[model samples]
Target: MDPSRSEFAIHEAAREGKAGVVDSLLNANPKLATQKDDDDRLPIHWAIANNHLDITSTLINTRNFDPDTPDGSGWTPLMIASSLKDNQGEQTVDLLLQKDVEVNAQSFNGQTALHFASSKDNLDIARKLIEHKASTRLKDKRGQLPLHRAAAVGSMPIVKLLLENKSPLNASDVDGMTALHHATSEGHGDAAVALLKAGAETDKRDMDGRLAIDTAPDAKVRKFILQSAEREGIEIVTS
Candidate 1:
């Protein structure tokens, strides 16, 4: 197979997990290994995006393969793996980390692997990224921290992990909404409780002057946050 004719074919093969085809294409022209498609994605990006571990491994081993190269959207292989929803994704992440890829590489949207892991509520992936030194405090384009993403998604375990790693508990976003506010607004009572326990300010308000308690999605959530504040000896005065 001519490498020029197989450009799209190679990417498709990787995406579909046809390792043999990818190998043939690479052997035909080693330069094909680093060629980008219209999406600015190499074979490796397609393989990682589709959770094709074997194909991903093959592509990463190719000479001059830029593992950290972002696609058209500025999403690195690590960032793509972090956003995956399967154990294969975790394995891909492990492989990338082993290769010493940038643990904290950001996308065009300024989202890190930790940000993606936290937002997706993938505790295992989040833990691995954290262990690899992925920053928990790095804010995205929205000025939202990983803690904010975890809280918004009601990821209590992730929230706890970030706190243990010294994530800023009361850090606010572009909206001036902290993790506590996100938890409350999303009706994540357990997340709210965890943030409060981690020293998130209950009285902290958003740009709208809405307190964390004020954003509670329901009465039950509001009551839970209020009770938690009472126990923390913090006053919950809403303006």
Candidate 2:
């Protein structure tokens, strides 16, 4: 989306990682830090999304800055930071965590920061959120847990972490699919095996009346999961 004119200077600056320009803009008008862009996002949102910790910290220090402020989509800075590419979003995540914010705050879709982090396979951010006592069992609007998001993306470490943190091993979503279902359907053989090893029930069926293996995108995925289960001594009754 194009900037809505000169009012977006600080937003653009933060988005571009122009620390100096952001500082200058903030110095000129401290309120710019809290000003929402056409996208309904504050400068802090862009800074955190771009992984500019310096700019993020600067914006945080501004007067009356709401650390848990939601954007147009009701996503907090933590959610954006969690979804960043690569593994460089930790600094921003840490910075936001240090502030007075809701660690388990949900978005418009009831997605927590953990959901974003897990969906992107951001292990570090997920760990940080977990350390901060982020809930492993908070289901999204779709009734999907963070574990489901992690499994769908084949984020094994996150899946393990959530499981270790006592996220329900077989919680079904609104669609009646568990994390195992998500892993198998997405062809994440390793994830499916991990869930199975963690004791995900194989007999559970989805709303479509398909077992987890039956939801696999193709026969190859189903075969790999079945073979892996066999190697792990986990019997999967496909008959």
Candidate 3:
């Protein structure tokens, strides 16, 4: 009955994937659904964070449930769901989405569900979020867009998807690095090529005045970017 005892009974049940127990506990004390545990997370936050779809569904149906409620770091359940990497994650996203969850809610750092999906390279979730009207252009605290995260992680499909959704092709982050810069510097050749073909400015210079190609970590990636740029008729200009 102590709030400081690590977690609530319902939280333990949810984290451990005990669907039946979670249901019973919620029935006993529906307020448990909204009660913050030791981690400042509601029971549903744990359920969805652990990819327990059934528990997430149960928690969502509880009275006064707010799909937009955030955890300690301002990470909403939808953001957490987007970061998950399985079919259950999809189910969880769908479950919360049915409640008209705020797909665009940002965390403490201004990262939305789209940002998380892009960062995790979850194309399906990213697509789903986009369908729900999540913004592809929401920037994080560092001014890095979802497109930037996708490029940095070498997620070519995600990069393409965000671009299709109108992510600014040449948007720069706090470091003045564009998505192309991230892709090239991280050594993602295919992604770099994709960015270039999509009309990414080859001469975009970062804070250090380094071009996207100049930021490439090696001769191979640099060579690929140059070759791909040449093929696409995108002139590669140095800073």
Candidate 4:
């Protein structure tokens, strides 16, 4: 180890997009390229998080780096890239995919890279993950898919994209609550409408045997769900 270099000097270089410095460190100590930060994030993890596409490519392709290594949060480099809110759009995501990063790798919550990408409303990231074989059907530990997260957060574009991916619109969570259940309960009427249009089973019941309308906290939400349900030729049972 270089006396002046901290344990995370490689990480710092990757995060700052100092490709040359990172190359030097990786060359001097190839193992340092894979060393985890305080958060258990390797230098590649920092590269993805910071959207250093060139550095990420160098680490992944040239170094034959491990892209599946998880961070302290059980998040992989792909997951970190998906969660990135910066980085000139999908440049980082695309680079990871080119290196064969596993898009469906799960975090501690069983949330895939797609989940984080959708939650961020990064259409480019989401699309890239999907294109790279991210499983749209895989749910988190709670049984909530990317669509459920999008619906709950009122991300219409993500909801639409997930629906287009043919995600099971009526797939339920651990509570047996479907994406519609979340959208209605969260008062996301527009999301509910989009879901219904995408063939989400509106009458699907939760573990409590309650429909989406039953959990709807407001009359407007209930009314919208009811309207969409009627249009979808499904019965809405509110208790």
For candidate 4, write residues 41-96 as lDDT tens digits: 88888887777888888888755477688988899877887787742537767766
The TM-scores, one per candidate, come to 0.93, 0.94, 0.94, 0.84
How does model 3 score by TM-score?
A: 0.94
Shift in Å, residue 215, candidate 3: 1.4
Rank by lDDT, descending? 2, 3, 1, 4
> What's the distance in Å from true for residue 135, model 3?
0.9
Ranking by TM-score: 3, 2, 1, 4
lDDT of 3 by residue, 1-239 (tens): 64323448888888889898887777777788899977789988899889887888888988999999999999999999999864348888888889999999999999999998888899999999999999988899999999999999999989989999989999999999999999989999999889888888877788998888888898988888788778877887875
Q: What are the runs in model 4 whose C-alpha is more than 4 Å off?
A: 1-4, 17-20, 86-89, 207-209, 227-235
Q: What local distance difference test score does each model get?
A: 0.86, 0.89, 0.88, 0.81
Model 4 TM-score (2 dp)? 0.84
The candidate with the higher lDDT, 1 or 3, is 3
Better of 2 and 4 by lDDT: 2
Q: Residue by residue across 1-239, what tens digits does model 1's lDDT show?
A: 76436548888888888888888888988898888898888889999888888888888888886668999999999988988874458988888888888988888889998998888888899999999888887888999999999999999999999999988889889999999899889999888887777777766789999988888778887888778778877676666
Give the clashing pairs for model 3: none
